[model samples]
Target chain A: MNIDSIQNGVVIDHIKAGKSMEIYNLLQLYNLDCPVALITNAHSGKMGAKDIIKIDSENLDIDLDVIGLIDPNATVNIIRHGQLVEKKALTLPLELRDVLKCKNPRCITSVEQDLSHVFRLTDKQSGTYRCLYCEAKAERRN
Target chain B: MRSLIDILELSTQEIDELIATANDIIEHPEAYREKCRYKKLATLFFEPSTRTRLSFEAAMYELGGQVLGFSEAQSSSAAKGESVADTVRTVSCYADIIAMRHPKEGAPLVASMAASVPVINAGDGGHNHPTQTLTDLLTITREKGRLNNLSVGFCGDLKFGRTVHSLITALSRYEGIKIVLISPDELKLPSYVKKDVLKKKGITYVQTRDLEAVMPELDILYMTRVQKERFFNEEDYLRLKDMYILTPDKLHNAKSDLSIMHPLPRVNEIHTSIDADPRACYFRQALCGKYIRMALILKLLEIE
Candidate 1:
């Protein structure tokens, strides 16, 4: 299957297999008017099998840090005139506000609907984030 | 300027100073009677509490400060669907300081973030209870005469006991503290607590199923209630509830100087006969709660 490559857009590559849809949802690519392609279980030499999201839009601004939270190993490439202009890597956000929800039922954020869910990165290797309120570990939703 | 959200937030020096202040207050009650005379304390309890609320009220009254606020969420604006932020903001205008207890884990934290005045977390769900930690520290210092180099046996519900968790975290800051976790297999201390607080600090600790086996080596035996509310399985609660009962027979092997402590409202964990024992310091521990809370009130209000 040949998905058309855009002249100017962002190509999110090297996503772990089967995680392209989550990245797409998090990036809210569905809300954008531009064409978006999610290639799942694509053949990759670096990662055994990878997922890729190609957003065909110029001058589109997305939070790379949030993308990092979704899939840190993924690479973001800016394509200008169908040529790679800039390549960026994702890193774990030290603190995330409203991106991750605290799963602890006893947490104040759960009871108080208006409060923003804040999670702070505790373990970098495990990619663990703890709730700012109750200190309960935020479970990554699959 | 920060609020006391957790017992872990207090430094060893601060804890020592608070203990000193509590001792001073206990010795000279008249000296601190009017220290917070004009200051008002708002006890915004969004949950029903008998001991903690009374302790805070008694502490403030003894310090010549006035107390106000509701007993439960039904009486407070919280029942009217008000946010913790808005409630604390409004209470901040009425009172000089706030001592709040909520059913939610971080409700006081939200209040602390919103209130301009100092906010004290009395108790929040199954989360941190810093005042109780203060009370425990004060009782330990007064009973054992030192906070360092002691073997503390925490028995009964270690899993869901917020007091046990907070006290263990606080004790990790002290020197030469060894924790003996005694409980049935079902109510063992949570793994996050073991990893984050104990192992990370390299604090020496041992987990055991037998309380009597470790009784002789303990300088402080802290007992916690196994609450039915904390258990998801009723059968598990019933089976594990009566596992460790500290009676006169159990105390035969215990150290003579061992201070038996408990965060009260206990249920059959300790026999009534054990109350007469000199080792029983749980009552004194409760009284110390008032004095330490008095010290804490003074410290938070910045009153000399």
Candidate 2:
């Protein structure tokens, strides 16, 4: 598959395999008018299998921290005038607001639809995010 | 200025201060009778709680503060699908402070975020009940005469007992605090609690299935009821039903001075026979609940 690289855009690489669709939906990349390439099950020496999303738009402004929350291993490469200008690695955000919804049934956010799903990164090594209100552990998604 | 969401939010000194204030209230009730005269406390209980709700109302009333709000969800706008944030935001306009109890774990936390006044989490599901922890702490300090250097054994339903979890988290902060967790393997204390709080704090603790064996070693024995509602399997509940019944025969092995505490509404965990035992302090624990809540109300309102 010959997917063209963007002259000035962001290439999100090393997303966990088959998670490209989730990333696509979360970032609302489908709403963008620019050409977007979502490559799934790409063989990689580091990840064994990975998903990569390449967005071909200079004005595509995405919160890279959000990508970090969803998929921490993913890396973002900024293309400037067809050259790699920045290779940014993702880190678990210290605080997240409305990125990942709290799944605990007893969490207030579950009953209150208008409340923002807020979480604080309690443990970095284990990637533990606790509900800001109920302190319930955020469930890990496959 | 802040909310009491978790027991860990309080420092040992703050806890001590609260205990001291509670002790003062016990000695001179008339002094605090007019503290919260013009204030109002909104008790937004979205769940059925006899002791917690009443204790909060009693606390506010004891401070001469009026109490309002519903005792359950069906009576309130929450049943109509109003959010916790909106409920508290609206209640904040009516009351000087809010004490909310919900079956959901983080509901009061969501309330605290929106409310302009201080929010007190009365009880939130199987999550933190800081006030209960405060009540337990005050009870222990009063009964044992010291908070440190005590071998405390937590018995029965350690798994889903929010009181046990909060007490363990709080007690770990005190010096010479040794915890003996006595529960069946199926209902043992959660590993995250063991790893994050106990081990991280370097608090020496041992887990055992035999309650009788550890009973003799404890200076304080905190008993918790095995909730039938928490179990999905009926057979599992029946099988583990009578694992640790504290009878007079079993109490013989325990220390005479062992301060027996329970965040009550217990069902068959403690025999009625043990009620006469001098060590049984659960009733006193309940009374302490009211007093500590008064201190908490004063602290939150900054009435001192």
Candidate 3:
């Protein structure tokens, strides 16, 4: 199978297999009017099985922090006029704001309707994110 | 502008300063009578904590400041579906400082973010009660004459004991503070707490189920009530509520000068017989709560 190369867009490569859907949903790719292609279990030389997302819009601005939190090894290539402009590597964010919700039932974010759910990175090795309000560990949604 | 959401927010120097101020208040009560004159404190308790609410009220009153606000959520606009942020935002206009207690953890944090005036976390569910930790610190300093080099035993419901967690976190900052965690397996202290507050700080701790065996090893016995409000099942609460009753018989092996302290509104976890014992300092802990709170109010209000 063959997918068309984007003229001006972003190519998110090196995603861990089966995580493209999560990245797509978190990035709200469905809301974008531009044509988007998600290639799963693609062949890679460095990574065994990788997922890639190709966004066919030059003007689109996506949250790289979301990608960083989910898959730090993922790389983003900015394509301009069918040529790679910038290749960017991702790292875990120190703090996430409104990107995820606190799962603690007793947390203030659970009761206060208008409050923004915030999580702070506590453990770098474990990639542990704790709720800013109650300090409850944030579990990644499967 | 400033808030006391966690006990760690206050530095050791600040804690010492507050303790000194509380000691000064105790020695020369007349001098602090007009410290907070014309200032107002709002006791915004969304939960039904008679002791903490009254402590803040009494603290402000003793500082020559007036007090206002509701004791429970039913009496406040929270009953009308108003948010904590909105309530405190409005309360900031009327009061110089706000001492808020809510059943939802981190509600006071939300209040601090929204309110213009300083906010003190009186208590917030089973998450944190910074002022209570300060009270415990003051009580310990008064009883033992020092905060460091003591073996502190925390008994009862360690799982849901906010005071235990806060005090441990606070005391972990001191040198030579060894924590003896006494609780049944079902109500053991949470691993995250042990890691974040103890292990990470390199504080020595020992977990045990047999309180009697560790009784003599303790310098300060911090007893906590198994909170029924934190339980989803009544049967579990009933089974664990009476687990660690600090009867006089339990004190035979304990040190004669041991500080038997509890964040009060105690259930049967501590026997009424222990009340008359000189080792019992829970009542004195409550009084320390007021004085430390008075210092907290003065500090927050930046009063001379």
DockQ of each: 0.88, 0.78, 0.87
Q: After superposition, how far is residue B4 of candidate 3 from its true place, in Å?
A: 1.1
List the lowest-lDDT window of 10 residues for candidate 1 chain B: B1-10
| Segments in model 3 whose C-alpha atoms lie over 4 Å from true places | A45-48
Off by over 4 Å in 2: A41-50, A69-71, B233-235
Rank candidates by TM-score, best first.
Answer: 3, 1, 2
- Going through the candidates in the order shown, the clash numbers are 0, 1, 0
What is the TM-score of each predicted model, taking all chains together? 0.96, 0.94, 0.96
- Cα displacement (angstroms), candidate 2, residue B30, comes to 1.8
Clashing pairs in 2: A134-B106
Put down candidate 3 lDDT per residue, B32-118, tens digits, no spaces.
999888989999988888889988999999999999999989999999999998898899899999999998898998899899999
CA error at residue B25 for candidate 3, angstroms: 0.3
Candidate 1 CAPRI classification by DockQ: high
Candidate 3 lDDT score at position B22: 96
For model 1 the local lDDT of residue B173 reads 84
DockQ of 1: 0.88
